[model samples]
Every structure is written in C-alpha cells, then in structure tokens.
Target: MKVKMILPALTEAISPHWRPIKYSLFPPLGLATIAAFFQLDDEIVIQDEHIEAIDLEDEPDLVVIQVYITSAYRAYELADYYRQRGIYVALGGLHVTALPEEASLHADTIFIGPGEDTWPQFLKHWQVGKPEKVYVSRERSLIDLPKIRRDLIKRHLYLVPNSIVVSRGCPHHCDFCYKESFFKGGKSFYTETVDRALEEIAELPGRHLFFLDDHLFGDTRFASGLFDGMKGMGRVWQAAGTVHAVLQPNLLEKAVESGLRSLFIGFETLNSTNLRQQHKYHNLNRDYTEAIRRLHDLGVMINGSFVFGMDEDDETVFDRTVEWAINNGIETATFHILTPYPGTDLYQRMATENRLTSDNWDLYDTRHVVFQPNKMTAEVLEAGYLCAYRDFYRWNAIFQSVSTKNTWEQKLRHLIYAGAWKKFEFLWDLIIRAEQVNKVLPMLESVLDGFGKKSAIAIIA
Candidate 1:
C-alpha cells in the first residue's frame, strides 16, 4: 500500500523576513526519520506542506500527520480533508501525545508517546488489516533506537546540516514548558557513545552542525567526553541548554573550545519568585548578569528566551525584561506568552480553577494568551507580551545588538527579520485581546472577584 507522511508548517502563512521567500521549506526531521523505517518494497512519500502545497490527488492508501501545538489546527484540517476522501488517517507527535481524545476526533488511529516503538508495530498491524484505535508505548529511551536516517532529509532544507540528538528528557518542571510532559516526569538522557555521535558527524559533509537535543551537554562529565570526541571532527555546532549548564566553568570552556557557536538558553522570566514557584532551574545566590557576561566572554552567543503571564507579571514586566536583556548584551531573544498546554502542571491548575478560557486547540498556540491572569486582565497580559516583543526587536535595539557583533552578515540577518517579528507581535496582540474582550472577560472577572486580591509585586518579587 502507498504510504505518505505529512509535516505541517507552524503556520499556514509564510513570514517573508524570517524565511527566505524563494526557499520556504524546512527539513521535517521527524517524518524523514519515520520514512526510513519503511521497507524497500513500501512506497513512502514525504510531504512538507510548508515547502509545497499538499497534492490530495496523489491518493495515498495511508496518511500520517505529525504536528506540534503550533500546527495542531492545520493538522486537524488536513486529517479531515484526507479522511473524507476515504484515506486512512493517523495522528502522532507532541499535540496528539498531549490530547489523544481531542485528536481522535480527526484521526482513525492516534499514537501517543514516542512514535519509534509504536510506529513499527502499527505498520505491521496495518499490513494485516487490523489497525488499532490507538497505539501507545512507554516512552522509549533514545539509546534503544537506531541512529536517525539523515539521508532522507532533502538537501534543500539544510542551510547548515548535521543535526543529531544526544539527549531526550529534561529534569526541570517549568510551568510553561512542554518538556516536562514530553518525558512524563522522568528524566531520560540517552548517551549515544561518544564514538558513535562523532562518527556520524565525521561522515556528514557539513561543517556546521545542529544538535537537536533538548539539552546537549546534559551531564557535565559526559558532555566533556563528547566535547573531547568532537574536537577532531572539525565542525562548529549549536544546541539548546539551560543557563545552569552554561554557568559551569569547565563545561563552558569545553563547549567553546569544542566549537560551540550559539546556545539557546531558557531564561524564562526575570521574576525570581515565579522561577522558584515553577521549580525552574534558578540559582538564587548567583548573579544572572555575571553568568551572561561569562558566556559571552567565552565567545558563545546566547539566544535568550522569556515568557510573560506568570501571576507575578504586570505591565512593567516587559520593560524590565527588555532592560535585563540589553544590559546583559543578549545576542538574540524570543518572548512568548505563557501557554497552559494540556498535560502540563499549569494546565491542570488553570482547569481546576476554571481559569481556562476555551478548549480551542488553535488558540493554544504559544503566541496567544488563552487563560485568565491573576494580577492583570487578559488584555493587559496580551498587550504586555506584544509590547515586550516590539520593544526588544525595535530598530534601535536590533541595531545595537547586531553592531556589537563581529560580522556584517550577522547584522544583516537580524535586520532582515526584525520587521517580521514586529508584525507578528502586532497581529498576535489584536487576535488574543479581541478574543478575550468579546468572549472571556466576564467569566474571568467573576473568577478573579471570588479569588480575592493579593499583591502582584509580592508574588513576582
């Protein structure tokens, strides 16, 4: 039977500034890896909807859709469209894992947890004409799976190739983070023997590598060994990690000498109280300014992350964060509204308190504000988030950050995308605030009235 896998885009609309208009496709790593599992006789096609329009006329016997929360709506729409044509539809990925029942409405088969173990079983069942309603396996360690097939990834998707994952799970239980749910409360780190990781990198032709690990240097000692192995490979790499990891002097030096170029660090909020309450990794005694300075001194550019909408946050939170980022010389920053995703602690708390505004999956996008806030109205939270983005990516701010850089190319890329960031913030504010004012304000006011007043400053400080 003909099988096709679809990787939906984060959004249906393309941002010309962020993505090259001429080349709009991203390598669907998850779908590409799944395609590798098919046998030689099985005809498997991979479709990235972002790169090209979906050709429903191809008429595959089976269709698999992989989606994240940002692309949940598009996945549902595609599933419905294909199912109507008598195609068997299966749903998997982060969104499906979070809300299987909601996803089941559109899918004939829904797979939760890691797809590696369950996908092969499901395929065997399909061959026998006995596909189950749902297929789920206990989260498998990455060490159990074979090296992901990079050959399936189309060359066009690689501005810089050589993506590999060294770890799977996180230990932190951040309120707004989905990582806590992805691993289901347990920490799962897969140590793919240093020899194996480096061997794969050595074989790949690209000089630039992107480690897809949630955290690359998970265990400092293990990371040092990996760094030693990576030295001979002669490639520069980038990956995501926490500020705590970067603060370790030995790991920081090893990362820099081992060719680490950029690191994505989750600085989440400037509010220390919110950080502690959420159980985020925060060193209360250490100076954050000093930590940032140390990393920059080591020549590693930080892509700092921040989230707005904790009970402690107010209108001034935006300016405070912007000032913190600027003072520390953060190379790049991403600001998001706090989203209470299903299966997360924050989601359960909001649901229990009846602070959830709607069950619409589309509104759950991290860019939108979907729940009632304790310290401020929904309008204030939405506007504050937008203002934060605007203020951070303002022309002067971008210019200042980029000018401090050594290369003109880096400065140009920042300039090219700055306008798009501003537009995204403006559009997000309009949609989120309007939805709240028209539909959720009354319900929110009633809840807040009964909850009683407490100092927002005291909570966030």
Candidate 2:
C-alpha cells in the first residue's frame, strides 16, 4: 500500500509571512517509528510540515497523521483534506489520545495510547479493507520494538538528527503533565534489552545522541543496566531526568562515566508549597544547591526548567528562581507560565472552577497563560514568565553561570548558548511583526494595483 505520513505543524509556525527560521529543530521520531513497522512493499512518503510544505497533491492509499495539542486543528484539517480525496486517515498522539471521539469525526481511524501494538494490527486489517474505527494498545512491555527508520527522514533538516528513545512514560505524574493522559495508567516503562539500544546507537552515524525519553533515570535498575552496557560504547548523550534519579545510589556516577553529558531537570518551582500542589514532592526533599553542585561536579551541564503561576506562587517567584539558578551555575534555564492542557488534572480543576480563559489549543503552549492564578492575575503570570527568560539569558547571569566552568571551551559554549536564548526572544518578536504584516498585505497590494491601473489610464489619455 502507498502511505503518506504527516507530522503536522501549528498554523503560526508555517504562515507565509511569519514562519520561524529554525523550524526543523527536531525530526518527527514518532512518524518515523510508525513508518518502521511498515512492510518493504509499503511505498511510504513522510512529510514534516514544520520544515517543509505538505504535498497535498500526492495520491496515497493511506495517510497517517501525528497529533499534538498545539497542532490539533491543523491535524484535523489535513485529515479531512486527505479523507475528502478518498484516502484512509489514521490519527494518533497525545491530542487524539485525549479526545479520541472528537478526532474520530475527522479521521477514518483514531488510535488511543501507544501505537506499538495497535498500529501493526491496524495495518494488517487495512490491507484487507477491514480497518477498525479505533485501535487501542494495553501493552506495557517495551521490548522487541523495531528501531525507528531514520532512513525515511531527511536528516539534514534537523539541528540534531541523531536521536533515540530508551524509555517511555514518566513516574512523576505532576498535575499539569500531559504524560499522565498519554501513558495508560501513568506507568513508566523501560526497554527490556540494552543490547537493542546499543545496536541502534552503533548503527547511527553520530557519536553524540539525544535520548527522547521522558525520564532516563525514572527506573534506576533499568538505567543502571543500560548505563553499564553503554560504558565502553564511547558515546555521549543528553536526556531529561528528576533530581532524585541523579542522586540515586551509584547510578549517577555510572551514568556520567557512561557519557551522560547533560540533563534537563524539572525544578518546577522553588517553593515547597508549589511543589506539593503540583505533586512534584520529590523535588522538595533535595536541596536545589546541592543538586546543582553535584551535577556540575560530574562535568554535566544543567538545563533547569521552572514554571510560574502555581497556586502558592507570587510575582516574586520569577526573580527568586532566576537568581537561584544563576547562583548555582546552572548552564541553562527554561521558564514557562503554568498552562492547563486538556486531559490534565489542572485542566479539570480549572474547568470546574470556571477559571479557564479559553479552549484555544494554540494558546496552550507553555509560554501562554490559559487559566487564572490563585495568587496573581494572568497578566502578572505572563509578565513574570517573560521576565524570567529575560533575566536568565541576560549577559550578567550568563557570565556568572559560566564562571565555574573548569575550561575556557566549556565557558565559551555556555556563553554561546546563553546568546542563542537571547536571540530566540528577538526571533519571537520578528514573527509577531511578520504576522501583523501578513494581516494587512492583501489590502496594501489592492491599493497599489488600483494606483498602477489609474496611472496607466492617465498615460493612455
């Protein structure tokens, strides 16, 4: 069967007048992983709309669309478009998993939960013209899964094209986390074999890899075995994990020795009350300074993530968090306004209180504030989010954070990273201006055309 797989982009990301220059920051691993399950006879075409245009003119037997909450509307549009042309459409991902019925209205078949088990079954039935309306997977075993078909991807498009997923789901089910809904029962699972992971890494072209796992150290036993297997591989990687995992007995040392260069930790809030409210109590037990010091001592850079607008937070949260991060020599910090995504506990509570401002999925991005805060206004939350970013990326903060680096190269790299964050803010402003121009361009063009026609008439006269 001829199949076309799509990784839909948010409308704002693909606007003619306002597209981001750095659209292909990451390849669509989800689509590629799904593509890996297809038979050799299946002629497949993959399109990542964020990096390139979708060829709507292509005629395929089936269309597979990956859905994210921010791209839900666009995914629905693409599904409807392909379906109108008599193509079978399959929709799956976090968004569809959350609202399968709503997605079913647009696609021929919708998948709930992970596609590892359901996808192959659907494909088998599809070939015989007996595809089901919904396919659901209840498997928790993360063994014997096929390696992602990186050959299907245009690797040159992504900044870091070489990546792998060693684990799935996260144990810490924070109130605002979408993982709680995506993973059935919010259970974290690890790959049964480290040999398969090592084989995948060996096949890849690059020495540096990025593990797209929700949390690499969520399961210490699996992590320890994986790290021990990776020790002699001579490959460096970065992944996300909790502070508790880093401080685990003997695991952190083994992980670093195995080439874990950096980690992204969710130090969500500085306040203990906020941590409890978010159900991120694990973060409260460890001193933030001690965690940062230990990670830095292991020659690993820290990418600390923080969120504003928790019930126990006030405007002071931003400055305090930024200052703490800078003081502790954090390599980088990502700030977010508290966002209540669909299918999250926070969203349910906000809906019950009638505090949700809108169901606009586009605005659900972490940068936007969609719900009322308990202690401060939404405006204040938004402002604080911006302030946190600006302060963290400021020159003084960057210098302070890099001062502890042992080598000049490390210091220089951190400085460059800080500058990149600053430039990102500029790029954001440029997009907004481009959007404004997009809104008025048609009218401007019409006026110019009228003026040219009148000028031609005068010349004829």
Top-TM-score candidate index: 2
RMSD per model, one decimal: 12.3, 11.8
> How much does candidate 2 score in TM-score?
0.88
Range of the 10 consecutive residues with the lowest summed lDDT in candidate 2:
443-452
Per-residue CA lDDT of model 1 for 1-461, tens digit only, reads 78888988766244643443212313677876677667767778877765556777888999999978878988999999999999999998888888889899999999887666778888899889999999876756555455555665655533333566665665555776675665653334556667776766778774566787777777676688889877766566678888778777788787777778678888888778888767685444556777777776666667788988888888888899987786566766888888998888899989999999977776776677799987888898888888877778777887776665555443443343344434454543443333321232222222212211433233223
lDDT of each: 0.70, 0.78
Candidate 1 lDDT trough over 10 residues, lowest sum: 443-452
Per residue, candidate 2 scores C-alpha lDDT tens digits across 1-461 of 89999999975576655445435446788898889899978899899987667999989989999999889999999999989989989999999988888889999999998888888899789778899999887866668877788889877656557768877787777898987888764344646567777778788874567788888888787788888988887666778988888777688889888888778999888888888888887887787777777787777778899988999898788888888889887877878888888888988989999999988888888878888888888888898898888888878888988886876655655665555545564554464344332332222222212222344334223
TM-scores for every predicted model = 0.83, 0.88
Give me the displacement of residue 296 in model 2, in angstroms: 0.7
